[model samples]
Target: MATQTLALTRLAASAWGCSVRRAKELYTKVIRSVLAYGASAWHKVADTKKGPALSLTTVQNSCLRTVTGAYKATPQCYLETEAAVPPLDLYLSARAASFEIPTETTGKLQLLRGACIKAAEIINRERSARRRRQRRPQGATSETPVTLWPSDAQLASAKQWLGGQTVEKALKEKWEQRWFHAVTPTRGRRELAAESPPDCGACHRYDDMLKHEASVLMQACTGRIGLRSFLFTCRVPDVPTPLCNCGEGRETAEHLILYCKDFKESREHLATQLAPNSLRTRRDLAALTTKKDTARLIVKWLLRTGRLPLYKRAMEVGGPPEHVNLFRP
Candidate 1:
């Protein structure tokens, strides 16, 4: 049943379909609810056992991948952070723990009551410890705090016991750690905001932007687009090398946007559009993509380059009517 709902959501969550925000909403309201049906009754068992939890997690990972348009190799922690979705175990346990039963109820309700009480106790303990740490004086503890579950701990149970916000914080920390140490060329160059949710601010700011444009921007930012460099890393059979057609360097997002001679004209147009804010280096390009107006221009510039075949329609059709003079500074 969860698989069927996931199949339907794949279309709306696809690269050219809808914004990441909307895609995540669809997953949470539709597919996740379906997967967690009767969770209060079975969550306890699922938490301790791997079989059911693993199956549900597989479905969720697929949904998140589609929603984010991320590569298959992207870690599950990264996908969860990017989608702003809590881990499945944590989600299910929270749902179960929040279930309320009548005080006068008896019989079969006893098992559910016990499970909820146990989950609540675990959550309270963790929450209290977190508060204590936060209350500590600055620099009081030089030791690095542990944000992840212990290696020997049961996966689902440990996560299920944590509060939603706690789980999310830990996941974000884990993502930052992995991102910092990532060996992949493109991923290593990418940066994540410390305090912000992983959703693109640019996409949210430009409410009227086309879905395809948002999708392209996201792919470019994450380094998972159809660039030859990324394709080569994925071992795509047809991509002979990571080199751009111009032969100067690999066809990475950074290379194409900042240095590739092939897009020199488009880059010049981008500079003209973003007057007073030139793209002289990779840091300049990164700064440009963070702002709402400049990010839109970046999208336009990318579309004009005609390099991203997946977004060809956006280039031909152009942006919304109001954005016709988007290039005018």
Candidate 2:
């Protein structure tokens, strides 16, 4: 059900001017809220139970990984607690408890109260049966007496007890984890070279980025856009032999920005804006993304060349990838 919301959030990201926080906010309001709707009713059911929780959790983890842009191997425990998402069982039970049974209808409150009592009765019976089946240790301490049903007070204060409150500190810790993930060291220059490029540019507040920015940077930095070489490599039909339109050489990113005559005018201006000859080599052009002025210069060139927006249009027209987001007001 929430599968599409993940795509929706990516669209929302660009709509909200490529803001990651806005993307997360949209996730909370639209996607997460939908998943949590009517949660209390089935929270304690088999699907939410221990050891065999259903795809509810799996789907949630996927969205959160989308939100934080964490690597796939990030632990599920981290995805939940750190991602500011509640456990399904706990959330459902608490949410169910939080609401007062609608009493406007005749006997509805009584029916609701009766349902709670029945649920509590079932829980107590199961626990008792399970406890009886277990072997006690030689010197285990005496257990507390179990209550079969919740008190009136427990029902009234379900929201508080279940603790749906947002913890700002926990969120900070979560962002901290994301930050750490972004800056985690790699094996050195060769490994860096083999990959397209890292977001070695100035860090975004979020580890990854909102949908639009992430998609653009992912390809631009990684050197995997639909340029001539990429088309030729894919054997795209009617593709010319991977040559630059400028007729000087093949149309690689470095060649276009560094040597192609087409962008030489803008390139010269950008070069003047940057330090002396810093962008001479392909490696330099890629690595210069880490420098503030140099990065700005590159952005100007890409903007002038229509590369960024072209890629952005591709991403939008091509349909958002699995983990993209679009922000909303």
Candidate 3:
């Protein structure tokens, strides 16, 4: 079932046809619903044992990757955060717990409800303990674990004990911490992540962009573009150093967009469109890309610079008709 669903998901999220936001909607509404159809019956085993959840998780990760157009090696956590999708296990547990059974419900149905409640409690307890250990100081004596679940009275009213919003918040926090302490290899992404919102500002605005333009913008934002800095990190044989042809700094997405000397004329034109405030720093760039109008300007600026050669044809084909006159006096 998951195998068949994955094929449909891939087609829906294919680079040429779908926007990131639409892909995510399709996953949540169609793919996820199908995969977790009978989750209430088996969610306990799926949560307690790693094997049962692996297939579901694999499908989700593939779908998320397609949605974001991120590289194969991008971390799963990054994909989840960017796509604003919860972890598969957390989602399954929540889905199981949300089943509403009547007071007169008996036999297997009633037993299933009890089982789901217990599974949610157990899963919450384990997650709490694991988080406590992660937060513990190195070589520090372990303290008594606190009860993470709500009181019995509270639990009665908490249909979604593992609520989607709560899970999403925790996931964002975890992803932020990872981004903050990330090593040099992810410098570009780390910097962008710091300035952007937890759910990724650009992703939410993809609906306003052409498919090709959105794809290029996402790649540029995530530091997976054809830039010399990225190529050097990937150890592409031809890119000996991460320097720009302008001989000023590493040829990164940020550099190309904000500071490349060769793009001076184009930058001036871009600045005119941006108005009032000039694009001088990452914050400026982040703020610009989050809005539909300014993000289109960013894409146009990128196309004008001609830095991302791999996307040139696609951008030109889907670009505005007057894009050729973007920098003309």
Ranking 2 against 3 by lDDT, winner: 3
Lowest summed lDDT across 10 adjacent residues in model 2 is found at: 189-198
Instruction: Give Cα distance to truth, residue 209, candidate 1, Å.
Output: 3.0
lDDT of 2 by residue, 1-329 (tens): 65565575454432133344555566668776776786544444221334323556676667655654443444454444333455444444444554433241355666666787788777778876776789666577755544443244544444343344433333334334444454334522211123222222223423333344433332344344456765686687977688888889876666677898988888877878776757677677766754435554564456457644444564455344436533321
Off by over 4 Å in 1: 2-15, 44-51, 96-187, 190-207, 275-278, 317-329
User: Between 1 and 3, whose lDDT is larger?
Assistant: 3
What TM-score does prediction 3 earn?
Answer: 0.68
Give the root-mean-square deviation of each candidate in angstroms: 15.3, 12.5, 13.1
What are the clashing pairs of model 1?
none
Top candidate when judged by TM-score against the true structure: 3
Please write out the lDDT profile of model 3 over residues 124-196, one tens digit for every residue: 7896678687896678765454333223332342233434345345444544555455434444444453455
Q: What is the TM-score of each candidate against the true structure?
A: 0.63, 0.41, 0.68
lDDT for each of the candidates?
0.62, 0.51, 0.64
Off by over 4 Å in 3: 1-15, 45-49, 100-189, 200-202, 319-329
